[model samples]
Target: MTLHAHLTRTVARPLPITSVVIDDAFWSPRIEQGRTTTLPTQEHQLRTGGQFEALSLSWKPGDDNEPHIFWESDIAKWIEAASYSLAKRPDAELDASVDEAITLLAGAQQPDGYLNVYFTVVRPGERFTDLRDGHELYCAGHLMEAAAAHHGATGKTSLLTIARQYADLLIEQFAPGGPLEGGYDGHQEIELGLMRLAEATGDGRYRALARKMLEDRGTEPFYFEAEEQRRGTPGYFGFLFPDRAKLAERFREYNQSHAPVREQRDAVGHSVRAMYMYSAMADLAPQLDDDSMQAALAELWSSTTERKMYLTGGIGADPSIEGFAGDFDLPLHGAYAETCAAIGLVFWARRMAANTGEGRYIDVLERALFNGVLAGASAEGTHYFYGNPMLSRGDMTRNAWFGVACCPPNFARLVQSLETYAYAQTDDSAVINLYVSGAATFDFDGHALGLSVQSNYPWSGQVDVTVNTAPTVEKEIALRVPGWAQDVALRVAGEDHQVQVHEGYVRVRRTWRAGDVITLTFAIVPRITRARPEVDAAAGRVALERGPLVYCLEGVDNAGDVAQLSIGDGAALRDEWDDDLQAVRVSVDGTRHLNTSSSLYSSAKDSVEDATITAVPYYQWGNRGKSTMEIWIREDESASF
Candidate 1:
């Protein structure tokens, strides 16, 4: 596994953010809103919350809002998101603000390149003592990612210089035979961040360090357990749980250290941690050409998306650990599908798509992008939901901020970097992974190839691709045919081509000319979807799906609580445009069960009446004020009283 091995696995490269321009009716405005509204609002929150000030190392003991172990990562994610937004749409005020934060961070760095405010300012000598709860490496990973993003966006290496210094320190202290040998972060993030750093710096050492960390994880004599024993205390958050015996097991599994990374096939532990770790594994497997690692990732992906995932593409069911429950234990109302977890799933999905060149990964990516991840932020972009629940009891609503704010910045960065996920390219070919309306430039054998896409995706299934400029040499263009589409019709310059699908992509190879047009039409009609019988919660229920969007019934659209509504399996559904939402709404023939007896545990069945149920996109549910929302509706029965 050397740099040569990494180069050999290159299949397709995501077009740089600067090379693609998004002019979408659905996504353009949201990206702009994230830039103007979300980033600014989040910056204010970070500043007011003392995160920015804490970067200055000014916090003293007993001070208000004492710097927490994870605060740096929050601000680092914000900086990364702000950098992406700045890359697309520059704001002088925002740029200056980022510069100021970088200055503070640079000033806070220790002489040895260590840079964590909590350890440096609050607890000076306890730097690497408690890796399980310190979050030191996790914060370093985020800073490294932020530095890479900032350097790419502005071409300024000030942040990168600081990040690399810290990374070098980490490698020296944590690598084999080093002082912190056999130790890794309690949280699984630095591995992914090291990969990014390697790309940013064009340095193989970072990649080597990442590989070492991954290989070292899940080996005999767990690092976390050893580190915990060295501390000789329960570590932080130990007092929260009463049972000491169960607490040890919970702690080990919660951080994903129960088994070795390669042998750990099931998607266990904290959902976000598992996603990040699996994402790093997927990324390195191809680079290192490790077959066993790839196999483990595939099994973990199935365990996650197939058995543990919700209809909305949301993972993690238990709120207690803010992570996963057992298999098929998904509860619609009690779901703790954190927005960051969904974003991590998207990260893993994109890497998997690149690794295997498969469209199935894109299907799950699109599902989470439209529902689980998009539901995190409000339409205005100021408020956010930390946990996205499929069934809300009229109480869950977006808030301005949280004490431990992670999702807002995570959501901001993902949407800002949406263009990179839309398409990937190599020297002689390109792959369209998403259907967002955008224009992109790619290299075709040293010649510039220009392409523009036009589509009303998620709302409609028609897409038209035009080649503005092409090379004389023949090149291949691969368009992903979504797994959910019943059939896809393809045409090139008014000529219908045989729909020859390979590995879930329709690859068209030819010498392109200017003004050449390619058209794709998919059967994106509303359809009923049912879960597996193993899913006890949704065994007798069905959900609605149109294209990649999952539809949910909201109380505001339905006039009241939607808990009692039931749609028949054979009921007819119509798609109608709504003025309020400005999106397609699904109307279905349903029956509402009214409890006439009104007694607790009554033997008498409830009476039912005909109803016209209105459903909106799951992503657009909580926008119309607080309302009851439900995704899985009970199947209508013939014997209703």
Candidate 2:
């Protein structure tokens, strides 16, 4: 089915607000804090010969690989966050600072439409030559995304125009008939950004270009082959090629070759690259009305959500490849569920929710937002974690920003742009994807509508939605019944309605009045979920889940080595109030078997015994002092004992 038709049937109204509007509260404080502290501190470090900047750009002469702009993904993230902030507060003074950065970008752009300070100023004449390591296109892609976002937020076209010109240069240089024909970025991103540009600007040419880029990849030998040959070795140095055929062949060999763009299952490659490709596929699949592509995306989505994803909806469990290692490879200590990857997952999942109008997508998105993405930032939102470890020891520390601290800014931008993902649209239907206290006003099919949703979600399960629309406009309202809500009930206009729940949504169509109120109540029961036996980490274990939040047992909260702890049978599960955590504490009655003499470096795995293990929402795991944690634990069967 075409995405248009699906959207038409699934969403019949317009989202009152875009993500750009929602993310401000989450983004502005961070920007203000950074402006006064983080940014200046880093700049001081750069100026005063601090180790961070020195180490970042150390690849230069007489120094180690010092902090290169592109080496740390944070540069792009800050740009993105600045774009978001500018969008939310166009008239504010901070916008001027953002404009200053944009001005820097403008000054940084070359006549050829290329804009990389490091490449153009620091190392000239080497453009596109170091495909194995250079991040030219990758940088361009991020800049393009920021440009589009800035344009979208402010209605000013200056940055976007610059980005457009840059894209034009790329098109002129790399189009099938152009100078750089038959090549694709080994670090894929421009394709997705270009597609987003097309959507933002209503330009078919950009979309066509994005499609062409996807189609053009992997056609020839690897784009990096020549560079690798020149370098006398082939290491995954980053940017490799633009050859569509060769890239497709490599993707096929890697088992990502699905029939259409969407069918490519399993995540692979540099975490960012895989996500960018998936994002592009998501964008193009619906626009082109390609079911095969959607199916392919669905396959990939299932692989990640079902078999590969962490409890936080974060992908990429392997630090070695900075990507997914394999199914069920989630090792707590070594797990590299990068914060940026989680942000990317949120990005992809949000698109899927829009495309399919399925609550499941939003469910996953919420999981990522509340846990994986939230974990990236501290409660105060200053310090950040680039890697969201499932389990953390006191040894784990939050860094200010890493050489690759792209995740923090990305988190900032996402938090700033979060409002848009909270709601979705169609001509006559509206679906509320999130339950946050907010009001939205938008026009749908010439009908003026206003929606106010008031609820404390994640912290509370009650959501109240009030709709005000044109008297003559009859609309359907679909409320997402989260997957974790096994027993959900909804009341409209104080009347009990017999509703059918399908695909995670309860659809209600009726004539609406201005003050009509719809209340949805989900039985947010705390339950234990057992993983399939094939999942090694989850063998003989079960994880706690409440609503959409996955619960874990942290050693700080539970007095035992989490790794050796096991839940005994016949233990009653009880909920106790913990004022310190401000959430319900789950207590399980089980015996705690102590292996006091076990050595830390023992070759033999510690034996598990019956014990009372209390688990809290995974989102709250790291709030206490860092300690061992476990999401899944053994469920004892000896209840009668």
Which candidate gets the maximum TM-score versus the true structure?
Answer: 1
Model 2 reaches what TM-score against the true structure? 0.86
Clashing pairs in 1: 218-260
lDDT of each: 0.87, 0.66
lDDT of candidate 2 over 96-194, digit per residue (tens) = 656665665676677888766556545666666554356677777777787777777677787788788888887777766775665566667777777
Worst 10 residues of 1 by lDDT: 1-10
Query: Which residue runs of candidate 1 sit more than 4 Å off their true CA positions?
Result: 1-7, 242-249, 639-641
Question: Taking the tens digit of each residue's C-alpha lDDT, what string does model 1 give over 511-610?
Answer: 9999999998888889999988888888789899999999999998887989989987588889987877878999988888889785778888888888
- Model 2 scores worst on lDDT over the 10 consecutive residues at 1-10
What TM-score does each of the candidates earn?
Answer: 0.97, 0.86
Clashes (N, CA, C under 3 Å) per candidate: 1, 48
Candidate 2 overall Cα lDDT vs. reference?
0.66
